[model samples]
Target chain A: MRVDYRPRRVSSAIAVLAAAGSVAALATVSEQYLAVGISLAGVLVLAFGAAVYRRGLRVLGVPIALVGVAVGFAGFGVGVSLVGVYDRSFTYTGELIGLLGLPFIALGVLPVHRRLSRRLVSLGFAFLVLGVVFTGAVNGTGPDPIPLLLGIVAAIVAWDAGEQAINLGDQLGSDARTWPAELSHSGGTAVFGGLSVGTGLVMFNADITGLPLESLLLLLGAALVLMVALYK
Target chain B: MSNATADTTTKARATNTDAATDADAATDAEVETATSSSYGQRVSTDADGDDLVVEGERRRTGRWRGIVAVALFASAVGVLANTPFLLLATVPVAAYAAYPRLTGSPSATLAVERVIDDDTPDRGDDVEVTVRITNTGRWPLTDVRFVDGVPPMLAVREGSPRHATFLWPGTTTEFSYTVGAEYGRHQFDPVTALLRDVSGGTELEAEVDCDPATVLTCTDAVPEVPLRKQTRHSTGRLVTDDGGAGIEFHRTREYQKGDPMSRIDWKRYAKTGQLTTVEFREERAATIVLLVDARPSAYRASAEGEPHGLAYNLAGAEQLLTALGETRDYVGLAAIGREFCWLAAGVGLEHELTARELLATHPVLSTVPPDEDPTDPDEQAAELRKRLSGDAQVVLLSPLGDEYITSLALSLEASGHPVTVVSPDVTSDATVGSRLAGVDRENRISSLRQAEIPVVDWTVDEPLGTTIVNSTEVMD
Candidate 1:
């Protein structure tokens, strides 16, 4: 009945490895899309692990979300860096990653407390929406673009650092071995299972992702309940 | 031994050591100890009635880590079915189930000990009682209450039971209460204690026999006015004629002035030289008898403020025994209501001491010996009827409510046994406003008056001196 508030253990080594894997997954998947979205499942697993394990969430959430946004942005940051052979489409620096999308993933699910994480994530989401609105207003690029882009980079870095700090916090406990596992699992879910799924669905449905968000989310939720009821 | 308040420290240590050992030895099987049975199973009967007891249930698991299981499931589902936030709603629901946070094991002993500071009490006298509850188990006691069974013969109201919030293994909690007492030797059969477990869903019961101890001591109603003259052959300050040594004259005789200075009769010498000074002697009572009662009805229950006649009568018996015992007089005892209860009369403090001890130690209901001489009653009546062989004084100890005793008192008077009725007050009905008690009182007093037996009605409130001073027979 009494909450054991004592600091718990953390696995620093596992956390670093999880963060590296999440970023690497997003980078490789961005360049090499497999159409079926099986890589999306990997992202989801990492996200779910982060959310469930206290330390895992803190370690993996920011890195995975930031990496996904970074991958999306890398395609946009360079002009004509990628020209699809299928349609000879022009890939612009801001268009592919969508200057604002990465910010949402980086900032949304990384805070220690749920409310703060939600607020920060929502604000980032709002910025992304603004980017779309601004892009439509200016017909593509804003007046002061570098600072805005740097601001995007700064936001992602801040979120990643915050996630690392929370997951590796002395406050959660000095238990080195337990913390990394807790942070990686919990942080990974808050992002991949939590935010990444939102981004992936939103992108898929909103032409931003070229897929359906609600239907995809519904299928995932239903599948979840069935899997647990059957397997667990 | 470690002086820990509730044996918690000892239990903690034992739990650390014993549980580890047990866990290693019986890793697969759960062991149930001797203290596992609940209190309801400990009930047993005694002379008074069935002793009361206390009892409860318990159950333990590794389900605490299951809280995180939701996330892993949520993730797999999110990828397969495409939903991500489904688990957010199930967050708070994951904290259910009963889990033991207890660190150690408790000892297997639950003991109940009751100590009556004083078992014998005078009516309206305060007596202290203590009940100690000990938990020998290593577990912490959540809630516990102890109840003491008081005999109905004693006028006791339900007092607050003591609570031992925590009784660790090898630890005890002693609870005490101050209770007012009435006369008579009341018995304490068994002590009952109920204890609860950490979860409070289970309980424990324990009952232990505690030897009876006196709580309220009702001494004889002490007489206020000191008697100036001691009874003949009775031990006291009174001077008597049949004595071994005396400063007073028993006879007068003619004597010469030349006799020893101490023996010379100065008045006789001045008048006629015939030294005829009277010789003085000390007086003493020949025999003294104390009559007590042990009839089944004599031990009937009475009111709270006013006890039954038996308690008062016993109190009076105590006083008379003390007074007579002090004078070094031959004292005899008789229980009027029951079978032959008279003890052979003897002299000195030892005799009265024996009688006092007999009354003090006697229970309300004493079984009549089957071996009594078949003719002792009639023979005793005949013996009482014989003249008091020269100034034997008799102290009749009674509630003065029995009719048969009054007739016996008259016969004793006729037999020349000078009798003093020393009654202990059983006067709840003296005012008549009390209807039920009044009828019983009226019948009792009438029987004494018609028989011409001197009666002393003792009231609990008034001192014994008032009864003696108000007696018309004693003044005469």
Candidate 2:
């Protein structure tokens, strides 16, 4: 009775797809060849780490994937020197390469740790928020909101799907036939992401130029309501 | 050994095409509850039969915590930075956080039926267990996860017992796994279902009983168990000290006038003037009692998947019964466990069947270890001694894992009943604790042997018959 608790195939597929989509969207918005190259290298390292993990060195593989994340972040720092930090495109590139590392970090922690802790997922999510804050630091009319918005949604989906995959892995193990549950969860997240993008696009196009405070307060109130709903 | 017949009455009816259509028609009138109003309540109160038992409260699995944190963080950052895009992304994350509250806990109206390929398998044979789960509720169960309760004695050889899947109403799902069977009667436990609502947020735990209550009975043909030299007065095979009319010669004496002609020593009469009568050893039946030590300590095993020491003890006890049954000897069975089990010394076909059934199904000789210490060993010994016939020899089957059993054997031998010990060795050098336990057990066996008890030190890896034969030679 060998117990193998590796994440299922479908959820992992959805995670990688969502992560790659996020990186591609950010790279295209940034319009930098260096951003694409750095993101590709990060993804390749992540793939290598995943292969190593599949070979049964589960403990060793997580650190290797985490190293890949470190390399991606380090690559972004080095790119900032060559590409210039003040420009809006440089910030987008930084955000792109940084966001590219999120899924691997999620993948690295999920199967190996086997606890119900949310630290790893939260860490990746925090990185997404930090990237958005960094992009806003440049503040040059929000860098064509559509791709940026889609990139954010995709990153969130990637983390959510990764967490769900690991949850299934803990409960059922990798050998169980968990495709239906995994696919259903991923499908629900994708649908919500699509609807969010649609609603976000509509709001962007509405073009109400005044009353920014009211809008901000309204968003904060909605967030407070959601939090209360969850706790209740 | 026999297969317990699968009870077809407990099997859920397979929904046919007509039934599916009727269910579909009934679906429209039954307001679709894929939403928040039915979140906490059991959806199918109308479901009859009450086979599935749902227990425990709605436990929050904390699966949505990360997503909710992300939603809150994104909203806070977006509001402060005035970035509408990041704020917009919060909408979807918030939706996911709310998804759990918007869904109802599945009815958990699942019918679980298990079918064993071979209910009465031979020792060490692979037995396949197929489990079929059918959703009899109206709503589709989106995130159904369960792990079948495999018998503790059997180890799974192929496939996994854990499964997660979605089941639509009237649909059935099946999964099968193989387990290597061991000696004894093993009953499968109920399947544990961890049912989560459509969103993996809220979970309801339940136990689902399988139809037929699958039980695997694996038994071996009785092996030869050699007894001590003690014997009863009845005529049988064991040679006793008293000289009488038998095949083996004992001595010669002066012939009496009334002695039968066949008993007279003709050769001695021809050699000498004085006539002598030849005396032979008397053969008589021995009454034997097989006592199994099934205390908690005897439930130890050398390895994780190996059968425990008590299992070996029960096997040895069964062998002794069958072997003694073949002779004219009166044989009985007894065990010291959670309960004291005893059968009076008897010799008949019906008695043998009763003894065998007791070995197979007695709670005292259960395959699983008792949670608490059994009743006092002294009390059980007194009860056993009271029941044993005066001339009956006791064959004690024990693992000799602890001091109490060794003391018990010595006490029985100290009494009028001659005792022979068959100790099954389940010790290994796998860990420091196991090694120490092995040393302790070795000391116990040596101390028992010091009391002049004929002990068969049977290593579990080999057949008990060979060990008994080897020990019998040593005893002789």
Considering every candidate listed, which one attains the maximal DockQ? 2
Weakest 10 consecutive residues, lDDT, candidate 2 chain A? Answer: A103-112
lDDT of 1: 0.42
lDDT of each: 0.42, 0.70
- Score residue B121 of candidate 1 by CA lDDT: 56
Writing each residue's lDDT as its tens digit, candidate 1 over B360-402 gives 4343223222233233345555544452344555667665454
Candidate 2, CAPRI quality class derived from DockQ: acceptable
Model 1's C-alpha root-mean-square deviation from the true structure amounts to 25.3
Q: iRMS for all predictions? A: 17.8, 2.6
Q: State the lDDT at B306 in candidate 2.
A: 76
Q: For every candidate, how close is chain A to the native chain A in TM-score?
A: 0.29, 0.74
Structural similarity to truth (TM-score) of each candidate: 0.39, 0.70
**Model 2: how far residue B397 lies from native, Å:** 5.5
Q: Number of clashes in every candidate structure?
A: 90, 0
| Docking level for model 1 | incorrect
Clashing pairs in 2: none
